[model samples]
Target: MPVSKPLRKALQHTADECIDCGKCMTYCRFLAESGSPLSIALTALSADENVDALSHRTYDCSACGLCSAVCPVNAEPDNIFTELRYHAQANGIFKLDQYAPLLNYERLGQRFPFKGESLPEGCTTVFFPGCTLPAMFPDATRIAFKILKRNNPKTGLVLNCCSKPSKMLGLKSKYEESLSALVHTLERKGIKKILTACPNCHVTFKQFNTRLEIVSIYEELKKSSFLPVTPSVKEVTVHDPCVTRSEDSIHKAVRELLKAMGVRVLEMKHNKSNTLCCGEGGGTNMHNNAYARNWSRKRINEAQRTGVPMATYCAGCVNFLGSDYPTAHILDLLLVKRKSIPKPVAFPFNYLNRLIFRFTAL
Candidate 1:
């Protein structure tokens, strides 16, 4: 692929900034002897040098930002990958398949139940349930909605995709178009505050310059006292998504939420600020499934070491570990024994309305 002058300059800039301090190796499992040279070469190469090879390694990146954190010089390997993904897609070095689940965002505006329906006039906060939350894990989705309705019935929700997957997949044009639609939808509905459940979506939409206040649904639960205590004893390990824990407070919030639910929170040694990538975030799941599965398996094994089920805030993390661990969303844990267990979809276990009372009341 022929790289333009501007792209070449950017790649050179990335290579020049890297200090080769080996800090990135700690976060990458694939940074062994043979791959070391490839990493170095990719770092050193101009944007035009071996576009396929660059894009191949780029797709391998989960874009977790761990490398940036560990770097003594503060060099950002993930941002370099992001820049490359943009340049590569624009220059024809990358292409995403049509049916890839990430592309579902483009179809969301038309399919959402709230499309033509009007939200209540007086509602100030609207829950924007991202697509994966509802489709992949229906039971958890119901619990999230149930929690909001039980405490704050006035809260309306705009159900649809956030188009982050599309952006990660290098479909920049499509991502922007979908985002514009979503923005208009919120504007038309008079939604001023958005409560997002999906970590990826929450972070993605937060990047846009908009007036609507975006807050995590978990944050709202923490403040509104909307979450109910359930009697359930389960040792749970949480897999923090790279996108969600940028500031590390989300990790603490998740732990607090779990502890409040009577679930013993077990830490993965590499958790909190140092959590491993979920392998789905930065286009890896779409471009390379086997790699994503391998990473997910590694995480599942770590969770299994604790001898308990796992919980995560991100739907992608749960979907990534489907059927591998006795995993459920944090909302699912909260819903246990309160409402009837929602029918198990092809996703995480609901386990709601089945709370083990022995574990209740702190």
Candidate 2:
């Protein structure tokens, strides 16, 4: 697990680019409270001093990309932190045991991928509902696929993990190999377009496999005539997942979907570009549950301050944030007809949903 020369150089370059203006620190909750801003940590890395301190700071980062988003010089501290994780791993400073559960989850996904057989002959577009959605909301997953097929008869369904867990965990080589293989498989099957349900999957596909067209299902739904059997809820605070902070189009589509369902969308204190992580980004929650939960609680508290329930498009977000406050997936608000607010999918059931989707939907 030697760190690549290019990555080392890139880390050094990122460190060199830091001007110590403290903009990233001003925005990053982890850094602001911890007193070890990325700029300071990167400087220490370049100086080859306080290596242990640097490793701790890097591991503690949520990798939400907010630091990078606010960096005036585009220093990309978030990317730097990822590279630092790899660096620590190569140096035997970071252990894998803490992340065993997440790694095992990813291993299962890679081993038991669910490539559905519901596509028409010569279909070039596949609806990829990523692992979380199919695992948490199988019915919504099915409905989304049917809507896609209705809009275009050639639309198909492909259920699989996007290997984002590996990527976020700094298993760079493994992630690249698996993702590339998946992309090649889809290309061989003439999958020119991928309709993604998970924001992480959407970002991962667009980042790793640029050869194919990657579009969010939310965006696709906007172009279709499908309307949700609106729920009884009137207003909700939309928690835009951190992965799609830069994806204005996806954000717009999610809000529009809510408006179409006659629900008034309330903005969180941090929404859109400034949205906080749901504690799952960069696989931080796998290693640091308390830290992750604190972030989720902060978000839930903010939503509660608005006197409305929390709503998010990401199934992962709903699962994590729902524990702290009343949270529902936008699909639940749009699609489910429950007389009461929908509950988040619990653990064993979520895992069961993944298995059921593979056997039944495929």
Candidate 3:
């Protein structure tokens, strides 16, 4: 596989900037275990003989950006690995079979993409509950919509995929097409503000569609007078989704909401900006399931050390962490009055939930 000149230059630039401080490796389980940080791996890739070994290392990364986040020199290994994925895909060095299930899921989303229920006249804000939220917690989705509608009669609902899965899969052109269509739809409908439930969707809208104002549902709920009855559980550890690590406001807002519901928030050792990935990040589970599970195990262990149940806002995070820990979504605390933690939906049910949302909610 021949690397393009641009990619080679990018990799070389990252290699040159790396100081081998080992800060990134401390945050990266894959790099720590493999003993190959960007400093060493990218440098090795500069030689053609090391491409195969380096490529395998690149795929091993979850691209969760933990390394980049802790990099003192601003050498973004995650970005470099992303470019490497593109390079591998272009040169036909990477196999797509492992990614077929995720690809097919994205394809289904594209095929039956959700449309927003129209807003009343002069309304500009709509609730863009991302795909997973509706699928995993249908009742929560409905409750969120009802609250939004109650707060503002013109509040609308938009159910659609944000195409993060496609982006993570290194299908740049496909992701752009999906994103462009979404932006066009919002613009066409005169939507100026989006209240997003999923952190992935919130970040995607902020990155790709800057023309619109993106606010988390947590933030919106904070301002509104809507408060559901509190659940039986009082104290739980929070697992912030890795994608929105930089967004302190979302993190604060989630905690505030939990506090309002009279739930005592137990802080994990890794919280806010320093949070770990939920193992499902960057589509790593598709290609490197073992590596992904290692991350999840580490996070679950940390939560267990706190001696409290784990709670997260992202449906994806809840699903991933719930397999190992007594994980619950914040919505469960707010919307449900149950005494026990909700069970994570099983394999086929997870897929079926998405389909159910596509047909019924959309």
Candidate 4:
């Protein structure tokens, strides 16, 4: 498929502005193999080279924005690669089988059988426990909503997918359609705010919606009531999710909550805005397993730096990081307070748990 005007403009900006400082390549492997943003842009936009040849290179990016974060000249190469991905998805170049999981997840967005929304009397706000969390930690999902409901009588529960998988997969037109439908749905439900646990959901909704206020559950939980946690691991490393990289408030809120619980936060080298991806960014794990594994390994190694268990906010991180290292979602610490890290649920059980949680919560 030919490069669209927007894609071309982004590429041209990188090609013209990138000075090849290689700061972006300091941590990311994708940039290492693909060369500087300028070189990639020149190769991609060159009249002689077929854009089709770079399909693999484009999909390999985790789209974690580390490149843009480190670039001295602010030539966001990640944004350029994102545009390239939309081009690949548009031109029918991506392998359908490779993206089956993301495609299936997107298909269930609003129509999800377990999306049982419960709005309180005169409610204008909701606790949106997004897809991954509900699947992997249904009890924590319910406990999160219960805390919000107790704090704000107007706050209610809504089990929904933010369709971030669609956005990451570069389903441009379809992604817009999904976002519009979600906005309209919230409007119909009189929802004015979303208190979300999923970092990707917070990022995705904030990107497209203006009327509805998007907030992190971590921030909300700061004020909301939850059981006092006697933390299983007192001193722990924190892995901030990529979507909340720049949301200083969210990062602080997480730390404040831990501090209130008397849990010591041993900082990782990559924390806060500089946090690495948990291997699940941009649907990269679906299309490029090796790249995804590399990212997960990086995060795991960072946790070992402090030589303590890891606590993160994103449930996807808990799931992907698996048992390779001791990692638990913050909600698990606050709500469940297990003696050890919880293992990720298998595929069919994950769905079953969601369904059960939805039915039982209703």
Clashes of each: 4, 0, 0, 0
TM-score of 2: 0.92
Residue 313's lDDT within candidate 1 is 79
In order, what is each prediction's RMSD in angstroms?
A: 6.1, 2.3, 2.4, 1.6
- Which scores higher on TM-score, 1 or 3? 3
- Of the candidates numbered 2 and 3, which has the greater lDDT value? 3
Candidate 3 positional error at 228, Å: 2.3
TM-score of candidate 4 relative to the true fold: 0.95
Candidate 3 residue lDDT tens string, 50-155 = 6645655677778788887888887766766777777666666677788887777666655644433556787799888876777678778778878988998888
Off by over 4 Å in 4: none
Per-candidate TM-score against the hidden true structure: 0.82, 0.92, 0.91, 0.95
Best by TM-score: 4
Question: TM-score-based ranking, best first?
Answer: 4, 2, 3, 1
Candidate 3 residue 171 C-alpha distance from true site, Å: 1.0
Ranking by lDDT: 4, 3, 2, 1
Better of 1 and 2 by lDDT: 2
lDDT tens digits, residue span 1-362, model 2: 34456555656666677687877676566677665344554554555545545655566678888777777887766765777666666566777788888778777776755444456798999998877887778888877777888888888877667888878766778888889988898888888999988998999998884699999988888888987885768898899999888999999999999999888988988899888888877677767677677677778778888999888889988877777788878776677677766677888898888888888766
Question: Per-residue error at 38 for model 2, in Å?
Answer: 5.7
